[model samples]
Target: MRKLYCLISLLALIAILCTGAYCQSPRTANHQPALAASNDAQRTADAREGQRILMWAGWIIGAFFVACTLYLAVERRRVVASKDAELAGKSQELLIIQEQVNQTNEELMAINANLESIVEERTLKLSKVNCELDMFLYRSSHDLRRPVTTLMGLVEVSKLGFDENTAKYLFSKINDTAVHMDTMLEKFFMINTINHESTEIGEVNFEEILDSVQHSSLVHNYAEQVQFDVVVEPGIRIVADPQLITFILKNLIDNAIVFRCKDGKRQPVIRIEVRPVGNAVGISVHDNGIGIAEANLSEIFTLFYRGSEASKGNGLGLYVVRKAIEKLNGNITVSSRLNEFTCFHITLPPSANVQIQTEAAARPVLITA
Candidate 1:
């Protein structure tokens, strides 16, 4: 393009120089006749006309070249604009990709934080379970050994010759020890059953259950002296593991009988009430027993927690009660005042068609001595 411009410029310059030469050549000529001068003047006039034509041609060519340059410049600007638009689009895409990457990173960070929190929570739960298991094992071994050792000693004493009355007394003591051991073993069995067995949820006849419990060996002897007042809501059934409910009731009733005040100030009475509390069956076992002291309330439900010196239990009754209640997705709360009365309230939730309760939990209690 530069070469073309230079060529056009050169041609214009040549046209201007040729016009000047033609206009001066007539002046440089020697003095001549009028006719010759006139002829020279005529040649000059023709040269001037030719110069004008060349000049117009140069001007036209220059104008055409300028138009072409303007067109080329416009085309160059359009190409640059197209390239700028494409680059701008790519930059926008890059920015969007960066934003997406940032969002992904943020999500990953949040997930990581949540996982950390979950792991920490699980670790704490595992630690607590381990501690409880250890405590359970230690206490269970000691309790089992104590009864076995006593029975062994009793057997050795029986081997020694004794009077008939002494023999009877020894045998009776032996029988009592054996019964206590059996009760402890049964409690252990229940514990194992509750822990290992999956819940077999079904409809339970509360009335039939009450009849059986009242007739059981554990309650029959106590019934002779202690009054049992049982009030069950009519036509009400419980949807739960019957065995678990039976276990819970059996323990509570037994505790009511065993822990009764023997001072004879007030008659020993146990009131068992079953009624509906919201969507669940609420069972309350209240006894006018030598009730729990205010201080022992919190420890009563702990494994191997023996709240009273008069307690003949293996210290697993209330613990097993709580565990069984939890297995059935129930809640239990205890209220007691020393030498007055003790009340244990239990709420059992249905397994299906309703939400189960969180767990067995005691309320603010004045509990066992």
Candidate 2:
């Protein structure tokens, strides 16, 4: 547009200069008066023509400038609108990003709070464990040293040259002390083994397992004072760790025997009954024995908790029994009346059924009292 305006201005200036030269020429001044007059008229017409061309050129240039200005204004407005739209879009995106950041911060805060709670819980558990450990150490040391100290005192007394009857009594007391120490050590070892050892799962023959336990008790004279009876569903078998189950049964049976009622005229009876319960097997060791006191029942399973003053127990048998039952995913519950009966009902995992026999001999067998 500028080039076009410049070209029009240059052409208008050339026309004006040509018209002035024609009007002011010296040849025209020397011409006859008629011819000079004629030349003046022609110069006048050419100047008028040049003036009209200049006017048209000015209008054209003005129109061209106006069109360019309007075009530029429209283009600038379009550019501004595009930039505004882009800015608005970017602002929206920034707002979304801010929201996401705020949400992330909230989640982090929640996680931090939960972590604090978890840490507090774990600290309490650790403190409790530490206290229990301290008590265990104190009690275990006392129990362990008592028998040794008694044995040493007895030895010193024997060295003082006692008579034959006194010597015999001292020897018996020393033997009893040694046996007590041995029992305590054996229980301690059993507890350690149960805590550390891992046993495998297998098909367990309850009849065989119960028989073995009964035979062991009999050999140890546990059955001598108590009438033993066993009633089990025939061919009943279970899947569990045999050693662990055996340990649980043996401990319960032994407890029943040891705590039998000595004052009753009738023989103390320990009856074993087994049956199926849902997806599990139930075994109850019911005894007409000196039952546990209600207040002591809850603490019976605690380590080194003794119920009776006459109890020869080191107070680990029930604790070991409970641990062994847990290993097989089983549970034991007790119901008893003081000096009448105590029943330990145990539920074990599902058992395997290998056969179905109906005869009395093949059915659930009862041990003859």
Candidate 3:
């Protein structure tokens, strides 16, 4: 639309120029005859009149063009002012957003600092609590043992003065209760002393440990009726605390017998196998008794955790085993099927032949008299 208007304006200007030139050219050609007389005056007047009309037309056109230009300039300035105002408003908004971002960053930094301080405080408190608990357990268990020992001795003395039948019943009850109390206290003492202790790495014969444990726990009395296979190769010797190793095996064997199947048709079996792992020995106690549920296997080593279907126990056997194994820098794993079988794999470092000989030489003499 603007292009068509400009083109028409240009064409009108060209036509006016051509008309002015043509009129001037004719006047110039007839100049001498016209200017020598009165007729010259008339021609001059006519020329002045044409000049006046042309000047008036030029003034009107120039004024119209100036008015249009002024109106366009005013409109352009208004548009520019409006756009500048909008830009200023956006700039203010950006400043507010920047301030908000800075505030959020400051809050985040403060939160992180607070969290770090909280973690440090909790860690120190936890360490102190653990130390206090260990000290308490050690002192408490030791203090309780004196009274329990005195009571057990008195009971034995009282048994000798009474009739045989009455004394037997009373003595049995007293022994059982005292033994249970001692075991509970001993467990606390064990937990307190077991951690961070240096392990005595010696040649631990699994067969010997099993035999001693069976004799002591009376698991062998039930073993006669059970068809269990103990497959322990003689050369397998693990590096661990010998007494602790015996304790662990005794607990495992006791658990096996405690949950033995009572089915008359299918005979119960408990297989104890020791195999050589790299730089260690793997002793597994596999029992075809009342197997543990899948969910209970992980919790079996937790202190005082007894499963729903488990037989009555203090639930410290596996916990004790784990503590002892950890002291020896070993690990234990478990796999089980419900009512089918359960296997516990304990891996411990193997004692070298030189260390075994050294241990043998360090034995003390016993006075048998």
TM-score: model 1 vs. ground truth: 0.74
Candidate 3: which pairs clash? none
Which scores higher on lDDT, 1 or 2? 1
Give lDDT per model, in order.
0.81, 0.77, 0.70
Q: TM per model?
A: 0.74, 0.63, 0.50
**Model 1 lDDT per residue over 104-205, tens place:** 999999999999999999999899778878998898888889888988998899888789999989889888888888888888999899989887876676
Output the TM-score of candidate 2.
0.63
Worst 10 residues of 2 by lDDT: 351-360
Candidate 2: lDDT over CA atoms?
0.77
- Regions of model 3 farther than 4 Å from truth: 1-171, 185-189, 218-228, 263-265, 349-369
Candidate 2 per-residue lDDT, tens place, 84-151, comes to 99999999999999999999999999999999999999999799668766876898899989998999
> Which stretch of 10 consecutive residues in model 1 shows the poorest summed lDDT?
360-369
Best by lDDT: 1
